[model samples]
Target chain A: MLRIFIAITDNEPGVLDRLASTFRRRGFNIHSLTVSPTLDPAVSRFTLVTDLDDKAARAAKSFLERLVNIHSVADVTGTTPLLRDTVLLRVAATGATQAGLFQIANLFQAEVLDVGADSMVLAGSGSPERIEAFMTALRPYGLLEMGRTGAVAMQRCAAAASLETAVSF
Target chain B: MERPPQPPESASASASARAELPGAQIIWRCLEREGVDVVFGYPGGTILPTYDAMVDAKVRHVLARHEQGATHMADGYARASGRTGVVIATSGPGATNLVTGLATAMMDSVPLVAITGQVPSPLLGTDAFQEVDVTGVTIPITKHNYLVRDPRDIAPALREAFALARSGRPGPVLVDITKDAQTRAAVFDWEAAAPRRHLRHVPPPVPDDLLAKAAAMIQGSRRPLILAGHGITLSGAHRALAAFAEKAGIPVAATLLGLDAFPPGHPLFLGFMGMHGSPWTNLAIQEADLLIALGMRFDDRVTGDPATFAPHARKIHVEIDATEVGKNIPVDLALLGDLKDVLDRLEPRTPSLDTGAWLKDLDGMKALFDAPTWPRVRKGEGMSPVDVLKELQAQAPGAVMVSDVGQHQMWEAQVMRHQRPRTLITSGGLGTMGFALPAAIGAKIACPDAEVWAVAGDGGIQMNSQELMTLTQEGLKIGIAVLNNFNLGMVRQWQTHFYGDRRSASTLTISPDFPMLARAYGLRGALARTPGEAAAAIREARAADASTLIEFQVDPEASVYPLIPPGARIQDMIHEPPSQEAPC
Candidate 1:
């Protein structure tokens, strides 16, 4: 059961220590985590993917409920999302294999964002599940290089920032 | 400057000057607000200003021999008085020392407030001198923690710390404040207002539907039993448990920490159950048709084989922490709330004492109380732990007995009959080794006149044995009776049972010549080998001449028995008497 909640926060020294601390102290396991400052100069968002049981998950919610300054925690699993993510992957692109790779990308609605000799980059953004499924199909062609930007989800209908954030994170 | 003659408004001026202070002062003000009169602490470079300010603020500071002992004292204090214990220490080593104590408090649900002095603000990340991330070190152990970087957040941090410690599901809280914040002088308007918190609340009363469901279960059971845990005591509902037990005519067993929740001699009371528990209590719990577990988290020792334990019985668990409700051993009817409040509301609605068949079965088990199988006293040597505890009980009769981990702990738990709630203190969850001495110090602080005793093993005392100095410095007259078995009694028992007596690090030599240690701390000390010797030493300690320690030389192999080895079937137990060897 992997559930991710991305939190954006002010880049104070102890901020991440405190934010990540809530998870560590409560015995929650992190499956994957990515942290870096985005467009905001003084703020960084952490894409925290957690492997938590139902009770642990609820406890995680309660723990985060009282955090000091988290800007917002977005449960970006499923929603009409606006924020984008990039996974730069260069796979074997020999002439014979290139058509197969192109077909694979086209089938998954992925655009051929970049292509090079013996390699290609597939660019797409919707949800993590979409990117993951494409990555699984591409594995057979041998992914030569790989990079992934976690789901940087933004809510729809209004300014994405209008969604209530728990704290300055 | 043309002011009316300010008629010595110095005091008001002082109060007003402190009205807008930040971080460190914020914590201090919170302490003042919490009515903290005494603090146990040791200052290093990191915590100097807080120490200095505490002195000026008129908070009595007793320096501890070690940070570990300081927290234990606070744990003892909380157990004794139903108030949170406060311990202050410098960062790094100071914060690390508090981990085990905090873990122990969490396990037992004791309320504790630990304030650590951090390194200066600028040097926080470069592995600065005396700077260890105190919050990081204690993250897993504390109920919650705050790192105070901003001065304005101080008072609120403290308010939250204390509230978190003693609130729903009480545990330890640490407030790690930086040195710069401590020394910063600001307009210190400090109010320890915890009104900001909205999410945390005492669980509501057990619903009527739930109580009726539980009552129905009680009505249906043929051989029903009630097992009370520290939750009953924490909720201040021991009386409620008794009322329910008596009204329903059910037999009750207790966890180690649940001692005295039901009057020890009450007809409905069955002795404690676990690895070291009496045979009959274990047997009785096994035969129950319905089991009601209130406030107790069934630790592994209590439930030997989780799948097989109490198989025939339908279990009901009432716990405040949802984490504990179903973590181990399933509960048929699980209600989460404060024990006392839940039981009080449900008592009247429960059926009047009509389970005659069930009551009679437990009453028959109670007859086994007279025949305790253990190493008998070999006349005129020194005081047995049981006898010494009994004499201590006779004098302070209602005093809280705090114990260190070991054979002595089991003996005190068995012998000292506590007639009141929150009277017997032991590290049940963590089983921390050197808990008794400092805990007794805290216990004495909790109740100045209530006779407090530290019943410990020779090995258990040495772990934080340095607390003897803290006791003398604090000017507390606490009675200490060491059941000196010359080895770590519990560890030695394991070697005997499984490893064929191949002793390892369990045997401790160069024993703390306790009398010498006592005198070094400006206190009195004595050695006892016989029951009479124990009585005399206890009598002298009770005189309030000074804090005293009595070192008892007992047979080294005198193991605590009627042992139920872990994972073994209920009836398969070692009922052997301890080896009666010569005292060292």
Candidate 2:
């Protein structure tokens, strides 16, 4: 099963390397990872997607929390969190398929980022499942290139106080 | 990056007004504040500034022949004294040499702080002369690490490194400071650089309900066994372990690293448990109704095949590291806290249970399956390793015995009895060879009044034997025992048993005369060919004022018995051959 983990860590020089190395050293395969600054400048937030069973996911959470710079780790899998993934797709499109591609993009609420003679670039952001469906819908148009920003997550409700207090420590 | 402003009232006026010192001086000041009286290290170009400041520093420095030896010395010091050991080295190869030692400490959870000097800040990523990313290389091995480019970060980094090294599940931590950082002068305030109070993870109080549940299980168990581990020694929970065991009449089995945690001669003590453990102990584990694992992870060596390990037992795991709870074997209950604290709380709630029948059954198995009687002695044969170890144990029962990895190590664990904690120090987790010589030096330095001995196999002793000069120079009166079996005895034994008797390259056909090697290092040396000779050599070495080495030419074909083949169930142990020949 795929698991999602959100980790808050101190913004130190090698925090990213440490986190990534922790996964590698423990033989945990990370499917995707995205790291960015949190609201607090001194801390960074990491969203990691890995394939793990329930027990292993818990073990991974415990391991991550053991790192000195890591403030908190939450396994948000199956928690109905606001998970989002962004993707930029460059599809091969001539004059004949431009209108159809735009119509399909409109249905998924994707934005057209660039238009060229032989290809058009579209940007989309949504749940991971929705993004997968969007990519499948545009597959017939010949995807010239694609870039994904993995996944980022947050609790649906206003439970920011827990993370805020954890990071301040 | 600009330096952050220090809190105004963080330090007293006197502390704040102290003269500014170079970052190198700040390092020593921090060590002094941390109550470190000695450090094991070697000097190099990158770390020259720190070495120069040692003239004014109060800390005594012991120059090591190699960086790797220094780290092991520090590790041994920590294990023997229950204090955080410190090691310092230069960059590049010097830093890399500490890798094995760091990994060894990490595996066994020894408390160590390693300080390494890196290339100047600007030359860090440029791969300047003798430059390497020490922190990056050590990230996976260290509990925590720092790369300080600013002079002001030195004190805080050292303080935090020391704190983290000794806190929670203790392990080695590293601090890699750039040469410029060490050379630059900075204002040093001990109070201002104090580690944050919240940095330490305070384990939550053991849940009362869980404690009650564990107690109920203990009270209900008829065949309960306690698996004591190194954590008992680390947390000073030996008394608690004894109390808990005696209260319920439980038999205790210890892991290899946990040999000394429980007194060996105690009636309730079942000899060491694991691959090479006594057959009775392993069989009891297999037959137990309940297993209370205290302060010990269920290493694979202990549980040969997890699927068939303790097939009938319900296990309760008490560990300080949460990751170790279910990492190896699933447990019925996991109480996360220091072993001493958990044992203290659980003891009060525990109900005394009758285990008389179980104890009697285990004793029968022990008498039947323990060390078998050897055949009649042959006239011209060499000494057996077990006999040598037994003689040493009889002669110096209280001396700290540090054994190197291999056959002699297992034999030492088997024959020598330990009565107190911190008496038997060996490389258990990492199984690193050549750990005994230097680690014994460290142990002796930490406990100057105590007798220390390093026991190693012929192959293992040669790995770090150069440290004998360090012993002679430092005037440390330590005994060195070499079980010279003329081969890597453990590997040869495995070949004899598992690999169809293909001797391969395990034989040490060409090796140094260890006694002569010691003599060359300005120490007394002797060679013993028979059991009586071995005893006399040990006696003479013990009485000598200077360091001494005794090489016992042991039986090359003799193997450690009651061995569990890799991945084999505990019941399938290969015992000693019937009517084994005894040495002269």
Candidate 3:
């Protein structure tokens, strides 16, 4: 199985909805998915995960590499230096559910930004894995709204060199 | 024809000073000095002047359809006669076309001199015309290359190129002459260029102690194997190897490129070893206690899993290239020098020991693997490549047999026998297809009295097979046979084993009926469907004494027997169970 980041058209209101529908139609199961807007006004990033085996993973990569409206797709399952994402969730004021959600948020180092008469909103920024795990823990609570940002990765300091440092082809 | 006038003395000092010794005039002088009796080439923009020159020189020029064909022809000729084979091509695309041929020669160490015309020097880097950096492109593939910077350099460069190509570890060399240089008058001074500046050799013997140690290892080892590669061919050490192996009672395995090292019918021969090699050979390799490899790189294809390859044996490697010594597999002992020189020194002091027990063990392995009598070879509807070579072998006996890359070549090497050095030519290292046909033409040109045959597979046959036209026009009497399986059998075999029986793209583009194509090129043709018919066609082709193409269409999916698939230890070979083992 491989984890990949995808760049796709972010303008359409239901782009993520359509993508998930396609996955279900192909009997494909995605382990994780997060979407977010970028500095580019017209595009969005999608960090996705799949449970495919090696051969199937290679075949799937080849297929996705040829899709239209796709800016790029990069697999960063291992050796990716740096990555971060953000998630914000609002939940109703329920006793046991609220207490459990607060404990999970505390575990992930999330900050409780607001407490309203009927709900509370929690915000956190960390790795996509951390964000997704937190979201799964909070799903049972009567969640009012939830939003998560896609993972954006950057090269780590000093170790981020490329082949150009060697020979000039 | 009146001889062209000599260049003025002033032009000698000025060097690049242009004069009017028409390109034709220069060609005549050049061919005369090089003793060039035959050339394989096609006419093009930059070579027009030189072709005109051939008319006046009375030299034979065979017009090949492709530049690659010309290069292979030259390679074949050199292998045939031990003389430098010379090929010609025009500039730009013509020069680029010879890349594969040059690489093929480089890998096998064939002696070839390729002369290519260049655009005028003024337009070289301007993108003015059909201009490629021929020198740069061929740098990795040639023993040496020269771009004539001045008209005066032509004679010396030509002499040097030819000399370098045939000396030491022979290889392809290129002499790129600018259009202006070919046109400009240069003093005709063949005598001025000496071979001293061109000779390549290593003086003196290797340390005597090295041979003594190797001798000790040979005597003590309970089981020993001799692995000889093309280095034996390059060093002209087949006789020494035979002497050494026979005296020591060592079973020998020839890498695909090392095909003719031991006479195929020798009692101690184990045939080819490595990926796609014989099960018997692989099993013997796995079981050997000690191994001495001569002039062969243990590539991944040859040593499926290097760590486990012949795991039971300690290795001793004798090779010319230092980088290859331990690149793939490590060696317990190393001797670097000319193989012939090293072997000759070892012959006298070699200790006599009967590895009877070792031989018995190897025989046991041979029996366990080489016993496959299936795919019953009969005079059915297809030609037997082995029989075709056999018939041709009977006629020529020692007429150098050269093969292009593919399964047919492996079959020919396994079945045919060569009694002399430089008699069996092949592109061993590069394994380039489309080598044999032109090479045979070159061979015939170099050794006119010797019979030459190009044994090729179907896919390889058509790569540069268009040279049949050249054969027809020159009326060169060479034997030609194609093992047409309608597919690239070697890779297809790999696909079967590694890719789960997925034939994939190994199938051919279907072929033009070989007989019609041969006749179209003004040559007699025949087809062999069975072993008997194959032999008969070969006899008939030799009798006709003209260019011929005999096609042998066999079962497309017939797996070459005795294969040791990649990544599998040789000991895991799937050999036939008894009832079919033949004595080596």
Better of 1 and 3 by TM-score: 1
lDDT tens string, model 1, B1-584?
Answer: 11232223543565565555545556676787789877877788788877766655756677888998888988888898888899999998888888888899978999899999888777877898778887777766777777776554566678778877877888888898888777664444444344344233455677889988998888888888888888888888887888899888888899898986889989778777888787778888889889999999889878887877887999889888766766678788988788887788778878875777766766566565443443233333334556666677777777678888877788777777788887899999898988888888888988997877788888887888788878777777878878787788789878877677778899877686887777877888888777787778777777867888888777666666667888886777666633543322
Q: How far is candidate 2 from the true structure (C-alpha RMSD, Å)?
A: 2.5
Q: Weakest 10 consecutive residues, lDDT, candidate 1 chain B?
A: B1-10
Among all candidates shown, the one with the greatest lDDT:
2
The reply for model 1, stretches above 4 Å from the true place, is A1-29, A33-86, A94-103, A127-129, A149-169, B1-19, B186-195, B368-385, B394-396, B577-584
* Residues A53-147 of candidate 2: C-alpha lDDT, one tens digit per residue: 88888888988888898888988887777889999999999999999999989999999999999999999999999999999999999998999
Q: Model 3, stretches more than 4 Å misplaced?
A: A1-169, B1-36, B56-59, B188-204, B370-399, B574-584
Encode model 1's per-residue lDDT on A1-169: one tens digit a residue: 7666777665655666776777876678776677777566666767777877666665675556445345556665455455456676778787879999989888888889788887888876556777788889899898888877765555676535544333422
lDDT of 2 by residue, B198-281 (tens): 353547878999999999999889999999999999999999999988888899999998899998889999888999898888
Answer with 2 or 3, whichever has the higher DockQ. Answer: 2
RMSD of each: 6.3, 2.5, 14.8
Docking class of 3: incorrect
- List per-prediction Cα lDDT, in the order shown: 0.76, 0.89, 0.72
* TM per prediction: 0.86, 0.96, 0.69
How high a TM-score does candidate 2 get? 0.96
**Candidate 3: which pairs clash?**
B73-B438, B77-B442, B77-B443, B381-B529, B382-B529, B382-B530
lDDT of 3 at B197: 34
Highest TM-score model number: 2
Model 2 residue B344 lDDT?
Answer: 90
Taken in order, the candidates have interface RMSDs of 8.7, 2.4, 25.7
